[model samples]
Target: MLDTSTDIRLVKKAIRGSVDAYGELIEIHKNYLYRMAYLHSGTEDAALEIVQETILKGFHSIKTLRNPELFRSWITRILIHISIDFHRKSVPSIQIDENLPETRSLGISIEERLDLYEAIRQLPEKYRLVIVLKYFDDLKQDEIAGIMNIPRGTVAAYLTRARKELRRSLKEGYLNG
Candidate 1:
């Protein structure tokens, strides 16, 4: 979670031409940004590129930010847009590396996790984005709507549809397995 007052101060300094302030602000949110990017892009390399692009774009346009308190959402909006665009222009692929260390701590078996990931990957782009932002990123529906530039109702609808689809897909996987 961001400290709003500190973010406001850093945002002000960054807007006023303080490179260190901008870097520090970005550093605070780098892991979060990468997670969002990785969830959206489905690849470490693409996620890294998306995060770098988001940081650069944020740096260039920090002065244009109207509310410093909303800096995290603002940068996140940029990352989401870049990720959506990147996905649109590229062929979609899913690569689940079973040996990844993060898989061990989730309590769920790796096979189950991989099945869930595959199910998520099979969802439509809008549904997938909603799932990633809402569940994976732990964003509220209103925040997701804001970041995704969609209505709150639409976000809710997407979540409903996405969850339904995930259930169907995962159940089918279980049956087949």
Candidate 2:
């Protein structure tokens, strides 16, 4: 995460066609962007492609950004667009090696993590985007609304519905599988 002042400086420099500043901004946000893309696509290759496309699109349009303060959100919006486009064209298929040892984190087993990820992937696109943007990307409702081009209230509503559906799906999965 970048401080407000540094972000402003970087945005200004990037807007001036400073590739180094653009590179710095990308370096700061790339990991989080990759994680979000990976969660959405469920494959490292697709995630990398999404990130790459996002960089290309963002770089080309950086000069058009009116507000430097919104740089992160703006770039994130680009990434979301690319992610949705990629998802529409590709069926996410990541094969897990059953023989490999699964690591545990925060009391959740790898299988449990995979289950949650699969469940999210199965959600309707609107609900899935809202859930992923809100939780995975740590974006606020207003930010998600801006990125999705929806009303803030709509974002809130989608999040509420998504959480309910996720709970139901997890419960069913636990009972059956």
Candidate 3:
């Protein structure tokens, strides 16, 4: 991961029209963008397309970014918007990818992870987004609020409700299984 200083430098260069610097910045964050997109869209193809759109949009608007250190957040906001727009324009289809990376270090079995993802998929869009941004991306609530253009208190409320719903769903699944 690039340090904040390096990201700031690259952002400055990109703002000065250095395509190479911009390319490097995108490369550094590509995996994160892909993961975020995939979590939001639930399909590899949609994730790839969303990432591509995010790259293009970021490239065009790099100069408009006011804070260089917040590049990740800014680009992430773009990806989220694109993902939401993509979903709105297309028929919603949720398919679990069997080859999702293992989280054994976190002591989560594949079956459990799949069940959690399925539960997340069933959530409303705002709730799902909060859960993904908070848990999956490890973003702070304030950051999530900024990215989603919602109040911080709203982010907290959504997170609380989302977690509650997820727990209920997972518990029911467990009991039913």
Candidate 4:
């Protein structure tokens, strides 16, 4: 991971049209962006496309970025916009069946995990987003608020409500047999 001062210097260089500096900065943040994209899109292919698009957009707008220190949040904001657009333009896939076979990947069985993801997927957009950005993306409440353009207190409220809804959904066996 690049230090803040190094990131700031790279951002400065990138803004001056230094492609190498830009590339280095992107490489440093690539994993973070990929994780966010994968969680948002729920597919490797889509996530890869989002990451590529994000890099392009970020590179193009590098000059407009006012704060070099906020590069991660700025790039992340761009990604969030692109992700929203991607989801808006794409057709939602219909699941034909809910019963999942037991298969372990990364030490977690598919049958057990699918239930959780299914429940999360069913949440209303606002609640689902807060949950995903908070837990999966590991973003702080303030960061989530900035991304969602909501107040910090609202983000907290949404999280509390989202957790409650998730608990109720899980308890009802909505996603489980």
Best by lDDT: 3
- Per-model TM values vs. the true structure: 0.87, 0.85, 0.89, 0.81
Candidate with best TM-score: 3
**Candidate 2 global Cα RMSD:** 4.1
Candidate number with the higher TM-score (1 or 3): 3
Cα lDDT computed for each candidate against the true fold: 0.81, 0.79, 0.83, 0.77
Runs in model 2 with CA error above 4 Å? 92-107, 172-177
Model 2 worst lDDT run, 10 consecutive residues:
97-106
* Candidate 3: tens digits of C-alpha lDDT, residues 1-177: 236787889988998899999999999888888889888877788889999999999999998988787788889989988988998997765787887743224356678877888888888889999988987787888989988889999999998888888889988433110
Candidate 1 lDDT:
0.81
lDDT of 3 at 68: 80
Task: Specify the poorest-scoring 10-residue window by lDDT in model 1.
Answer: 98-107
Ranking by lDDT: 3, 1, 2, 4
lDDT value, residue 51 of candidate 2? 93
Question: What does candidate 1's lDDT look like per residue over 77-129, in tens digits?
Answer: 88988987888887877575554323214356678877877788789988998
Stronger candidate by lDDT (2 vs 3): 3
What TM-score, to 2 decimals, does candidate 4 have?
0.81
